[model samples]
Target: DLLTLDVDHLVVVTHGFTAGLLVAAWIGMPVASAGHVAFPVPSGSITTLREDGFFHNRAVVTVGDVAHLVGVSGS
Candidate 1:
């Protein structure tokens, strides 16, 4: 249902491991393939997921980006 949402943008707040699974799912990667892989999602980090107009182009624009946390404590 999430993939068919009509919103122009959406945000999902979840645990690190869950977020990793989401990333893997978005990219069509098998869950079994993630066993040995690591998707580090640091606290206060941002991951950008994109779907372009009409064509339904999907992609992970950025992953675990903490640039906004720069100069902040414990970042």
Candidate 2:
């Protein structure tokens, strides 16, 4: 596993869906990521409430997302 090497910070830059993002965080490494794509949102799911993977309880770093979408909207 890429995480078995003991990465202190993981930067994932890819167009991955929500499930992929969740898997990345589940890896248990401090994660910093940026992606340009959509994350599936089902009714009552965390993604539905948060509206973005960056909003999840992970250390992912998302650049260029609609800032206003999460109340942290900024240019």
Question: Considering every candidate listed, which one attains the maximal lDDT?
Answer: 1
lDDT of 1 at 30: 86
What are the Cα lDDT values of the candidates?
0.83, 0.41
In candidate 1, what are the lDDT values of residues 1-75, reduced to their tens digit?
788887888888878587788888888788789665667888778999998787977888998999999998876
TM-score of 2: 0.27
Screening candidate 1 with a backbone cut-off below 3 angstroms (N, C-alpha, C), the clashing residue pairs are: none
Which parts of model 1 are misplaced by more than 4 Å? Answer: none
Give a tens-digit lDDT track for model 2, residues 1-75.
654554454443444365556544553434555243334533222321122245535443432344344553342
Error of 2 at 46 (Å): 15
In model 2, how large is the Cα lDDT of residue 50?
A: 20
